[model samples]
Target chain A: MCELLGMSANTPTDLCFSFTGLTQRGGNTGPHKDGWGVAFYEGKGVRLFHDPQPSCSSPIAELVQSYPIKSKTAICHIRQANVGEICLANTHPFVRERWGRYWVFAHNGQIANFSRQPGPCEPVGDTDSENIFCDLMNRIHHTLPRDAMPEQLAAVLVELAEEYAAQGVFNCLLSNGQWLFTYCSTKLASITRRAPFGPAQLKDADVTVDFEAETTPNDVVSIIATEPLTSDEAWDVYQPGEWKLWECGEVIASGKRQR
Target chain B: MCELLGMSANTPTDLCFSFTGLTQRGGNTGPHKDGWGVAFYEGKGVRLFHDPQPSCSSPIAELVQSYPIKSKTAICHIRQANVGEICLANTHPFVRERWGRYWVFAHNGQIANFSRQPGPCEPVGDTDSENIFCDLMNRIHHTLPRDAMPEQLAAVLVELAEEYAAQGVFNCLLSNGQWLFTYCSTKLASITRRAPFGPAQLKDADVTVDFEAETTPNDVVSIIATEPLTSDEAWDVYQPGEWKLWECGEVIASGKRQR
Candidate 1:
């Protein structure tokens, strides 16, 4: 299995603190040492940094930790080779442009022997994760209108997620800058911080960050990850077959897929 | 207007020398400093780095210069922001996937009052350059087969380039990792360095590099840019209606678009 990290915020925010903790798991604290990628959405643009290197030792990862690229929505992944070879093409957080918007997707767990009919949206990489993302894009393009409502999009996403989850693990994070949609098949967790934010210590790294000193009272930031990143915060663990649609750091809608 | 830089090589090569010189034009030595972006092709994958800040002082540019990300093909751009605002969305070197391959494009000139019928491919940013690219993509999708030959693609590209160039300036560089197609509407230059290489000095910066020390005898590296980057190299200037198809650091085909 790999690791996934996602963020949705009311205001532009940096993922340095949470990202630093996750990098530790990429090689130092865990065995997911293949590659990692992150996408930070600024308005309608997404700045992507991908490195086919171990996060703990990659210079690009180091820059990501030191530089504060603020964004309203973001998705990141650290991969452990399970279904694809260790290469830049097989890196996570695959991106595609659809409906005049950039869509970013990242997967955590594997879906064994997954295959689908080819369509307009094709996978550039040889990974089951990318294949599934392309399949999802094809379905969205064919099933929904260009200006479909967010709820309509979410419904389609949940239906596909449930189908894929039935084959194997299918936890994923997807976004189109306006909203973040996350689905859990086996493991997922999330935490939201607002006005009462306090200092939190990382579970993987010996680092502490005071959210009170960094964030404004009006700031609302939600973080979703495959595992809890902080020890002090009460992260809400998602039940299998559960999914949520996030916008402006809060869940607007959620549902449990009937197994 | 904007500045474009591209490289095609028989072997994987780094563009640190040329990139360092061109970055000096991004608000240091010249006035094209709205934003900058680069796409480096690794196998079928592409590593894209975009910064809305001036490249001369941007930390991301600093990282690119310091780190040698080798690739066989690469495309870069530095924008001056005439047709679009100074934002990440308006940054150049836009990318899209077509026929399961990433197509990277960067424009150095503008196409004023450009409008085309809606198609499957759409422009995410509000730039005339991106609009032209989307139109080109739509044309390719509808006009040619998925497995079209390089010459067929080039013929179609030249026809479109002539049409757009007649409307306004339309210098551009496009690549799909297999071949690089460059069209020069006004200003463009190129240089190919192979065996018997010597020292070269940057025109914008006080930096010198000895090609003999870095490259093997069998290496064939070609660079295409809006202007000659090095002071000592004899660059071949392209005519207003000229285009070339480059692969493995050599021009496999060349032609002039008749007005």
Candidate 2:
């Protein structure tokens, strides 16, 4: 399995602290040293970087650790190959164009005997995750309007996620330069930050930060991950078979279990 | 890159609705079809599944979509190869034993020059993402105390994540069967849901659901993603160089930006 990291904030923020800690996991702390990638959202645009190398020792990873790229939204991944070969084309945090906007996705699971016919959106590699993404695009193109409401689109997405969960593991993160949609089937967790910031420590590295000093009282930042990256802060656990829609660092809608 | 889908709720919920919508993206609407995986957290334990096939056509994905897996915290992913070969070892939602519990992760993005050196926790696959995960484990073992607080861990994790972000993209999701920590360097967004549930639809599929009918007044659910999956709903965006801690479907603490 892989690792996932994401952030949504009310203010433009730099991910320097969290990035540093997560980098250690790339090669220093954790066991998923396959590959790594990350994407940042900046005012309706996205900036992405990917490498077929471990983040612990990668020069690029080092550079990211030192640089402070500011944005409103971000997504990152570290891979553990389960389906595709170790190559640049098979890295996580895949990006695509949809409705004239950039969409990004990443995964940390596998589907059993999953296959799909070619579609308008094609995978650059042979990973099943990419194939699934393309298939979703095809379906989207064939279904809702390009400018549908978030609620409408979310309903359909929930339906599709439920269908996939029925088949096998379907843990995933997806974005379109706007909202972050998260769904879990097994082991996913998240944390959100608002007023009354506090201190935090990294479980993977020897470092700490006092969010109270860096954030405004009105700021709201939310994060979702497969696991907790820090050790001191309190994090909320997502219930199984649940999904939430996040907008501007707040959840607007969600799905419930059918009894 | 990989795709992530998560669901959170105030009450125990089934992911049948959103899973159906997200599964289509695995092979039909999106490009992260390399493989798929999911974990359903039932209380403290988790039910997980993985497969190295496109989710659209994978029997496993189909089963997940059809099955009504219920839990409070869940994580799912679909991969698009960028570092490791197409094999089961390269699949995501990687799990590990930590603090006498299971930790899970899913990632999106890549790091350059990550495979030069092997860390204490080596990558099971060739993907740089896996190597990074191993490195993180190694760092945790070396840096943090066995019974460190979540906030302390978050601080160190933020420092490490910042370092990695300087090198390249470092957005990610991580969990320790308790809380989820997420960091964003780029392209991360999210939404939180509580009372006033309404109808929602999918941008990629022709499906819709009325949350008001399916949820109670006390329901609170949150989601984080690489992008906004829906078209109608308003999704919050994450600022670059930011991280958040989540617990019980709510935001807790946040990081400061140094960029």
Candidate 3:
């Protein structure tokens, strides 16, 4: 299986610790050693780093590990290459511009028989994940106005996610520089750190970080991943068919449809 | 004025030495110190690195100089910020997706009163360069088919460049992973190296590279820039309003529209 890691924070925060833990799965602690990519949203612009090489040994991944690029929102993925060939074009997270904003997305689960031609948006690589993303973008372009409210956007996204989940596993994390949207078809987990931040130890690696030393009291930082990155932290697991809309590290809306 | 650096090669070639010279101009040597960006096309995939910080001191730029990310086509720019603020969104080279291909572009000149709103293609960055690119993409979408021939596309691009040049300086480089299109409204130079490759010394920095050590006999590598990068090599200068289409390190089509 692939792995995903996302962050939504009120203040600009670095993802070095969480990313280090997640990268371990890309050839070390986990079996997802195909390729890895990450996107950091800095205002309306985004910085993306993608490597077709395994994250465990990639020089670019090492640069990302050491470089402290702070961002309010981030999305990352380590691929196991189930649907697409192992190539640079197929690596995620994929980014496309829409409504004058760069929209970033990463997926962990796969859908079966998911063949759809692109409309206004197109998939450069032959990935079912990218195909699904293009389909979603096309639907959004046709179904909603450019000035749609965030809630309205989330509602449409939920409907799309539900339909994809009905097809197969459809865990995903999406962001458009303003907010984050997470959907769990099978498995996903999240944790928020605020006020009394504490030390946390990675379950896959031998690293420990004291969040209090890196953040202030009023900082609200939320992290979502395929699994709890830290064994000590109390991660809130998302049930199947669960979706959440997060803004400024706070969950503004959430729902779960019984399947 | 900003500087432009581009490469279209028959083989996957690294731009470390040339890029090192360009980085010096980003702050140390020349005055294009506001921002810098580069795009490397690998197959249908693109590896893009943009930094609002000056390239002379950017850690990401340092990695690019030493990491050896080879590609067949490359476009790079060091911005001096003529019409936009020094932010990530305003940095070049800007990227957009059209007809399922990622098109990378960079401009060394500026445009005046370029306020054409985006159509299906939007500009995430608020730069005159990006706005002009968005306008060009909109026109291309409206003017051509997805399967338009390369020459047909170049013809349309030339008309657009001529129109933009009438507004202001319009020297630029563009690529869609297949061929490189270079438009010279004011200044541009190019050199093609093949068998019996010799040493070349950079004019902006104290660096010399022996092409024979880094390449094979059949290798044909062409480089295009706003000015001659190497003081020792004889670079063919382009006339004002001259445009060239390069594929596999060779010029396929070229014309100069006398202003």
Candidate 4:
């Protein structure tokens, strides 16, 4: 299985610390290393960095860890290649433009026997994850109105997630720069850091960062991952069929469905 | 105005040498200091690197110059920002997937008062270049069949390029990994290097490269840019209304029209 990471912040914030922890799992602490990619949402624009090499040794990953590219919402994935070959096209997270906005998506788990009809949003690579992402985009393009709000969009997303989860695991993180929508079919966890931010130690690497020193009191930052990245932080684990819509580092709407 | 760079090769080749020269014009040698982006096509997959910062001093540009990411086709742009603001969203070359293939595009000239009807393929940023790109995609999506060959696509592209050129400047480089199609409304130049390659000196920077030492005899590499990147090489300048379709570093079809 692949590992997923996401972040939502009230202010533009960097994912250097969390990303460093996740990169360690990509090839060092864990074996989830076939390729890795990250998408950082800067306004309506997204900066994507994809490397087919293992994250642990990728020069691109090193640059990502060292550079402080601030973003309001970001999605990242470290792949272990259960379905697709190791190539730049098959690397997650995948991005597609919809409704004059960029939608970035990253999937962690697999969907057995997944198939979909070709649509406007076609997959350039032969990955089940990308196939489903294109499927979701096609559904949204055909069903949803152009000006659909987050709540209305989430309703459709939740419905699709439930159906996808029934087929197999469907844990995913999606964002359109404005909001982040995460769904959990098997494993997912998140932590929100606000005013009383404290120093946190990484579970995967010998790295620690004092959130208090880097963040302001009013700054709110939330991080979501397939597993909790920090050792000390109290992460909220998601139930099997849970979905949440996040904006400005807060969960605006959330629900759990029994699969 | 912006500086455009594109490459088409019979085999996988790195743009490090050419890119280094173009980047110098991003700020140090020219006025195009707004933003810069590059897309390297590895099969159907295109690895993109975008930065709103000026390429001459951008850290990401440094990495691109140093890393040898081999690709058969590539498109790059360094913007001066006339129709759009200097932001990540407006950076080029822009990318979208069509017919299960990634289409990468970069524009050098401006399109004044460019507008388009919204379609499935939309622009995430508000730029005249991106607006025209979406319009082109929409036209191809609606008019052309999914299985249309390169020639059929080029027929449609040449028509649209002529229409857009009538309004304002429309020098562009577009590729779908398989073939590269370039249209020149005002300024464009190209050079193809093969077996008997000699040493070349950069026009923009103090950099010299011995292509004879680096390339194989069978390798045919073609480079397209707004102007000749090297001082020593003789570049073929495009006429005002000229278009060419390139594959395997060779111009398979080319034509010129009087506007």
Q: Better model by lDDT, 3 or 4?
A: 4
lDDT of 1 by residue, B1-259 (tens): 8899999999999999999999999999989899999999999989999999999999999999989999999999999999878889889899999999999999988777899768888888899988899899988899989898888988898998888899999999999899999999999999999999999999999999999999999999999999999999899999999999999999998899666
Please give each candidate's TM-score: 0.99, 0.50, 0.98, 0.98
Once superposed on the true structure, which residue ranges of model 1 sit more than 4 Å away at CA? none
TM-score (chain B only), all candidates: 0.99, 0.92, 0.98, 0.98
What tens digits encode model 1's per-residue C-alpha lDDT throughout A91-146? 98999999889999999888888887678888888999999999999988898998
User: Which candidate leads the pack in lDDT?
Assistant: 1
| Model 2: docking quality category | incorrect
A138-230, model 4: which lDDT tens digit per residue?
998888997988889999999998988888989999988999999999999999999988999999998999999999999999999999999
Per-residue accuracy of model 2 over A130-198 as CA lDDT, tens digit each: 667767766776777978788998887777777777777777778876788787866677788887888
Q: What is model 3's interface RMSD?
A: 0.9
Please provide, for model 3 over B102-160, each residue's C-alpha lDDT reduced to its tens digit, 9 standing for 90 to 100: 99989978787787854888788778899999888889889999888888988999999
User: What is the alpha-carbon RMSD of candidate 1 to the true structure?
Assistant: 0.9
List residue ranges in candidate 3 displaced over 4 A.
none
Model 4 RMSD in Å is: 1.1
Which tens-of-lDDT digit does each residue in B130-219 have in candidate 4? 999999988888889988787888888899999988888999999888999999999999999998989999998899999999999999
Q: How well is candidate 1 docked (DockQ)?
A: 0.79
lDDT of 2 by residue, B1-259 (tens): 7767666555677776666666677779988788877776655445556667787777656666765666666777778898777665577776544443445677778888864333324454567766676667667767888677888889877887787777777777777656677888886777787779888887777888787887789887777777766777898788999887776677677775775
